[model samples]
Target: MAVITKYVVERSGVEKMTFTSKAEADAYDKMLDTADALQVLLSASNQLTDEAQAEALALYLAQQKEPLLVALGVKKAAKAGKQDSEEQTTAKQDDTSSKGLKAVAAGHAA
Candidate 1:
């Protein structure tokens, strides 16, 4: 028998998302919180009259906060670009390394 544990992020007593990792669940909750805060701030401006549009904008802004900060001069674009390249290199390395390991395991199993 096997048991699996799931992390759920709830908003207003409703399950909004479920994740197999706690880190992802927590990050999602933080994003949701940021969106809620941004929505309130945008509502105060009164520029976006439609509530749905305001909410949508808030979520978008929250999700793209890194790029938003860079565009607003609050973050360095160079740093973001470096991080992206590093992540891509790491992903490529993992894919290549796992391929050889999988082949070795398969040969031993056969």
Candidate 2:
């Protein structure tokens, strides 16, 4: 009998790619994870179109700044036909408010 190890990759909880080597899979996964983090900020901004946000995020990564640290909640996949754009927009605002509060608290402590 032979045993095989496969490197499965995912982004935003959806499988994206697969690799034969752990190093390759991990590298790609890390990049995707970073992009996901950036997307949260981009999504909340509502200023840039999706395309522009992606480009801006890539530029930021190219500069090699320390990655933004955000504590994310485990969100269930929205039920079909239950969530619409309006709800999504409101949720984004709520998320931004929480993040802002965290920043203010940190500032007060410092």
Maximum-lDDT candidate: 1
lDDT of 2 at 69: 23
Clashes of 1: 0
lDDT of 2 at 76: 31
Candidate 1: clashing pairs of residues: none
Candidate 2: where is the Cα deviation over 4 Å?
A: 1-4, 49-110
Residues 21-97, model 1: lDDT tens digits: 99999999999999999999999999999999999999999999888888998878977779999999999999999
Over the stretch 10-82, how does candidate 2's per-residue lDDT look in tens digits?
6568887888899999878777666667666676777767767675775466334332221122343345224
Global lDDT of model 1: 0.95
